[model samples]
Target: MPEYITLTIDGARIRVIEGTSVLDAALDHGICIPHLCHMRGVPDIGVCRLCLVEVVENGRSKITTSCTLGAKEGMVIRAHTEKILKLRRNVAELLVAEAPNSRAIQDIAVRCGVTEVRYPFHHANCVLCGRCVRVCSEVWQSKVLGFVGRGKDRHVALPFNERPEYCKRCWSCIDVCPMTITPCDGPMKEGEEYLCGKCASQLTMIENSPDSCVWCRLGEGFQCSRWRP
Candidate 1:
């Protein structure tokens, strides 16, 4: 028999299999926790920091990424508190500022209640979500892709900056990349980046019910687990 653990999320008691991450458990029960850099069946690195949740203990709370947080018996978690929403909104804003062209990032920003971006746009090409590198190494076991360099120079690249002949050419890396899906209006020009709030209306459902899954179209091609059939 499989062992199970019960945890409290947003005042609701949830029972889940032992060792399941809090993010997965909440998502399984239709609780929304926005995230990127997490792929089903792959080990979570918690790089995106989007699935953050507060764990209550000793009359206080500690914030951590739910994707890396294991479910334990009697655990108390708060996924949508005002503090969390504010921080998550800021994180989503930074993501959009970093890559305003990604429809996925734009949708996530709207879902996080970002009406404006406070930071200057870097307009960088990648957000370093590591989806491609993880998918290649963990899913395909190819290990052909990796992040090299350091600081701002860091980025994903083929080993030795060259594609080896043994490469499968599966292109699974590209399929899972968030950058592949540009904004509906196409690429933004230099110094012309702006938050795509066209889907802002969808946030109405989230506002009314913070914890319920509205099945917002935001996750369509972003492969958000909540959007899965």
Candidate 2:
């Protein structure tokens, strides 16, 4: 039998299994928390800051990633506060600016209400979400791909930039990468990268009910946890 703990999320009280992350608990109960770098069966590293939430302790609130914050008895979590929304929007904007070519990132930016990116676009291929590296190592157990380098030079790569002979060749890495799907306007040129807000039409229902799940396809491009059976 699984042990359960009760917690309050955005004024709603719910009981979830012990050891479940707050992000999972909310998503399972139909509360939407924008997140990347999180897979249902994989351990969450909170690489993407989009799932930021407020943890009310005493009289003050501390922001943290819900995917890494476990649910506990009597815990209070605020996922859609004005502060969190603004912070999430900023993070989403940065992600889109970093990799405007990804349809998944573009959709997420729209969901986060990113009208424009203030930062200069790097047009990098990866956002360091670790979805590919984590899924390759954790889920597939192949350990074929990993992060190498440090700081701005960090990136995912096969060992020595060569595919290993023992690799499972599952292609899970490619399937999980956000960059696999080009933007609705198609891939942009180096100096012509732009944020794709084509899916902004889907935001009406989401804006009306920020916390409720509308089954938005914003996450479909990257296989959001909500779409997992």
RMSD of each: 1.2, 1.0
Q: Which pairs of residues clash in candidate 2, taking residues 3 or more apart in a chain or in different chains?
A: none
Question: What is the Cα-based TM-score of model 2?
Answer: 0.97
Encode model 2's per-residue lDDT on 1-229: one tens digit a residue.
9999999999999899987999999999989999888888799999889999999999899999999999999999999999999999999999988988898999899888889989998879999999988888898788988989999999999999999997898888999988999987789998898877877668888878888878898856687788889
Model 1 global lDDT (CA atoms, 0 to 1)? 0.88
**Which tens-of-lDDT digit does each residue in 1-229 have in candidate 1?**
8899999999889999988999989988989898887777789999888989999998999999999999999999999999999989989999999999888998888888899999988778888989999888888889999999899899999878899886789999998888889998889987999988887577778888778778887856888887666
**Candidate that scores best on lDDT:** 2
User: What clash count goes with each model?
Assistant: 0, 0
Whole-model lDDT for model 2 versus the true structure? 0.89
List clashing residue pairs in candidate 1. none
Candidate 1 residue-wise lDDT at 168: 84
Report the Cα lDDT for residue 142, model 1.
93
